[model samples]
Target: MTITTTRPEPASADLGTDPQEPAGRRVLTGDRPTGPLHLGHYFGTLRNRVRLQRQGAELFVVVADYQVITDRDIADRLAEHSENLVIDYLATGLDPESATIFAHSAVPALNQLLLPFLSLVSVAELGRNPTVKDEIAHSRQSSVSGLMFTYPVHQAADILFCKADLVPVGQDQLPHLEVARTVARRFNERYGAGIFPRPRALLSEAPLLPGTDGGKMSKSRGNAIALAADEDETARLVRGARTDAERRISYDPAGRPGVAGLLQLAALCQDRTPGQLAEEIGNGGAAALKRTVTEAVNEHLRPIRARRAELAADRAHIRQVLRTGAERANAVADATLAEVRAAMGAVGSA
Candidate 1:
């Protein structure tokens, strides 16, 4: 995938005007909470989530706490990371009043749908999912856990539980969304009831953000600059970022990806395009390029970091926001589960 760093303006009216009501499609998207968010997440999904919410989409942002165990075994810091993820969401402009931000483990009814959902897709079909294949290939484990194997089905349940008709995902995630649509179709055909909506993938136009080393940005890679990083830290990382020996700066993603990535990052922090930024910084050398990138990144994230600090100070408030969101999610999930039970010829609690 190509690396792009252009931020789009939100085209909707003011948010929270009608907090209880949404004027657009239902959106479902989330993160694993493995670690703090970075610029990649900021440009990729976080910003888009806020934009969609502002556009009157009834957004459901799941933290996917349970999905953390699909690959790693570090549960000691899970709670801290999950709370931090919520803080990042808020800092990025996701209004809790308009967007439902909840964790997967907190929504029991949503997970319960997995039983029937699992039966709809065969093991062979599950094995064929490209997303799952990529995950397994990247995983450190020699053997796949059962949860890891059925991850795509679990994602299907996550989407169908809320009856989310639209899922914001990158191109790589389309196969996983397809599983949800398949499960919805098969369940409706087999049980003779449309209990779930076949969620559609709203593909993001923003390209991937490469790490400082010119690779896919990831927390585990240690190349990513966390959204919470201080200005000095951001500068240090950018200073050490890989760049070619050539002094002339140009946006040649194919030939000078490292320099180009920095240009893209700087452009994303403001309104200029990568090519325009490169032209403006002609012959400034890598030092000037890194300096420009550091300044832009820090300036862009300053207010967000300030908001994050305030939110982090009030730990109690953060937890309460999550609790309220979970309560709302449970109500929706329970209603869906009841409909699922009725369609499956099972009894719901009287």
Candidate 2:
């Protein structure tokens, strides 16, 4: 009903340089359109992306709208959700002008690109992909759809079409990243060389930042702290975070996940380490620790949330950004598509 065609390719940020890293490298990275970004994204990659942009690197922040269909449960908020994500991104330091910001649903050509790309990859390779295995296991969907099963292909198409050289990914996502690299290599091997640049993975500074509940901070698990959440919401969520019965404050993630989770949040917010904060706490009680961490998180996210609200007001502006981004993204993708077709002999040959 919502024009469920193949998702458009996402926008990427990276310099248009040769694979030899001439000048600088181009980057393609983004979050799923399933929900708003969270602290995990912020500290894990968003912060790094902002730093890269400032350093005169070309970058693309894809909204990954096509990924939403792999788990198309959020039918009501498909378009609206993607638009909100754009707003959150703008409020953060992801300047649209500096980077292309396209959604999956908007660029149908990327999906068309997937046909040939998927052929280059083998079924065994897809089966061996750890991320796909994890998603299947986590979703518990006995009969997985082809879309869910072949997500790596979509990822390959996403990065390949954009010719992204750098894709910052978490360690857990290495398997998928590997798939993308493998596909890039395979394409070059099948056709001539230089079909697409093999994207490098930028592993997170602190991979898998634990949620307030001491579990992987994910939306499905209800443990994530949304980036656009207000000060009151952030405080309430922090207050509800899991902690240990021991009153004394100490930072031991393995031994005391709940309490350590608080410390991690505090440290990340204050730009300190959990152990350092633990030493500073000396012999503070758990209540004091939670209160302190909550306050710190509140302080850190207050400005971000406020800025998000201001940006959310003009949804039209966000749409314009995405629209403008698609034009720029397609300009690059179309040329690449033509090259790919010519290389594969698909252009003039019926």
Candidate 3:
């Protein structure tokens, strides 16, 4: 049997002030604390999260520790990785006072919300999720974990537990958010109560920078420039980045993905377009282009790296920030879970 899937409409137009949500909107966005964040993350969603927080939106940035174990065999590194993730969030200008940041595993209520949400979605439907399919393919594993297979259901609980009206995600992730919307709709329909909001995807305006190999920027790919990378390491990575044999510096992504990748990185750093930079560099050659891109990246990252170093030294303060964040998050999540249980007529819902 053929199972067809329809993609959600890109919510680009809905980003500007939603008249429906006059009291402002609550937003939920997160990163799996599998590794240190990189420039790809900064441009992809981190910057947008900060902007939304400053605009008075109730923002929740979850350090998704539970999601990290989907593929990782070494669970011991989660502690260090989770800490580093929060440090990167702070260093990247995410104000703890403005945004509620917490680890996913810290919220037991969120996990409890998962069972009902899972019942709302079918196994065949879950198998059809584009994001899950892509992730499984990317994992290069022969067998899939049950936790990984049901990730979209868990993600639904994550958003609904906060009653998030907005979910900041890339275009590629819109389908996953759509699954959450479907689950929310199904639950409300079955329970005859509007407890969960259908979270809309807030499409990011930032340009996605490709990896050094011109593929998706990923930590496993080893092409990403970590936000915690020191100046020397950053410089070394950029200098050793792959580029075409063609000496002329032009922005033809299809023909020269390697050079185009560098140009895209430079464009993002300088807040300019790749074509504009390519034209300006006109025949400056690949060597000159690499040098310019490398400097721009290092200069941009210098302050963030310094801040991360300082935060790393004061582990006590980092722990405090996370501890307080967890408390704040639990307060909200617990209340939501209570309402969900009451709606479903679960025992001890009172």
Candidate 4:
């Protein structure tokens, strides 16, 4: 039951800027409405969004409804899912007043940027993009859609449409963000107008939280405990979480990912290091570890779940939030599109 003190450095080493420095920076980041957000979404990006909003960053949190159809043939309950995501954002402390939480489909001008941006990137480049490849493979489709093929370009449109200066991303998303950077550079060079900012990645410092089953947290796989899960549901999920047969608990990820993931989960909630927590729980066995994790997770998420219930009870308020955000997003996107048209000499009128 020994605890190891070693851990990998945070991903923020990619960019030296402090995440707390908000001044005049515009950030654009979001999630597709394909599934309910879980602990992974919280630690990965949602938490950052809230911090940025409070820090005074001009934030745009998109409910990427359009992207959901890239893999699924039919976006079942698309509207419901989108609203639910907005609720999660609200529950997690993102102010709709400070942050624009709009649906991607609602912003036509943003989607229009896709066509002009497509011209800037080569088909070969899209073919070689590892992120797109991984998404397509996981899509489990017999044939890929034309839209899915140009996924990165569409993302470029999303970023540049609002002239975002910063985009928070993980290592896996760096490739997608690179496409946006490339498009910005090429657009400015070809059109001779620096209309777009090369959005830089505000790489996350948080470790990737694994699912209860020790796999990637995925709502489809039922491994994730959604932000909306009640206290009983949270405890039940944690109790069923995978763990090794060792009688003692230790923070050895390589040797035992499941046990390590559980420890990490508890640590994130308790604001203590995994190694320290592991040492405290020395010789406590897997059941003791699971009990600790369940208490920590449920306690941490208690307020968020309560807020989600309050928000979900008011559907009208949720729709109004989306409407207002869409209005603001449309204005910004329209201005950007107009400038892009004027630069390209396509300036007659729609």
Against the reference, the lDDT scores of all candidates come to 0.86, 0.76, 0.82, 0.86
**For residues 105-170, could you state the per-residue lDDT of candidate 3 as single tens digits?**
888998888888888888998898888998888764467888889988888888988898888888
Candidate 3 Cα errors over 4 Å, as ranges? 1-9, 13-23, 140-142
The model with the greatest TM-score is 4
Q: Model 4: per-residue lDDT, tens digit, 132-169? A: 99999988467899878988888988899999888888
Q: Write the per-residue lDDT of candidate 1 for residues 1-350, one digit (tens) a residue.
A: 11112222222232334554345789888999888899999998888788778767899999999999887655548889999999999999999987899999999999999999888888888877788999999876668899899898899988988898878777787778878888888899899997777676766767789999999888999989999999999999999999999999999999998998999999999968999999989999999999999999999999999999999999999999999999999999999999889888886733
TM-score of 1: 0.93
Estimate, for each residue in 67-135, the C-alpha lDDT of model 2 and write its tens digit: 776755444577887887787777768888878899776777777788887887777768767788888
Query: Candidate 4, 264: how far from true, in Å?
Result: 0.3
State the lDDT at 61 in candidate 2.
71
Show the lowest summed lDDT stretch of 10 residues, model 1: 1-10
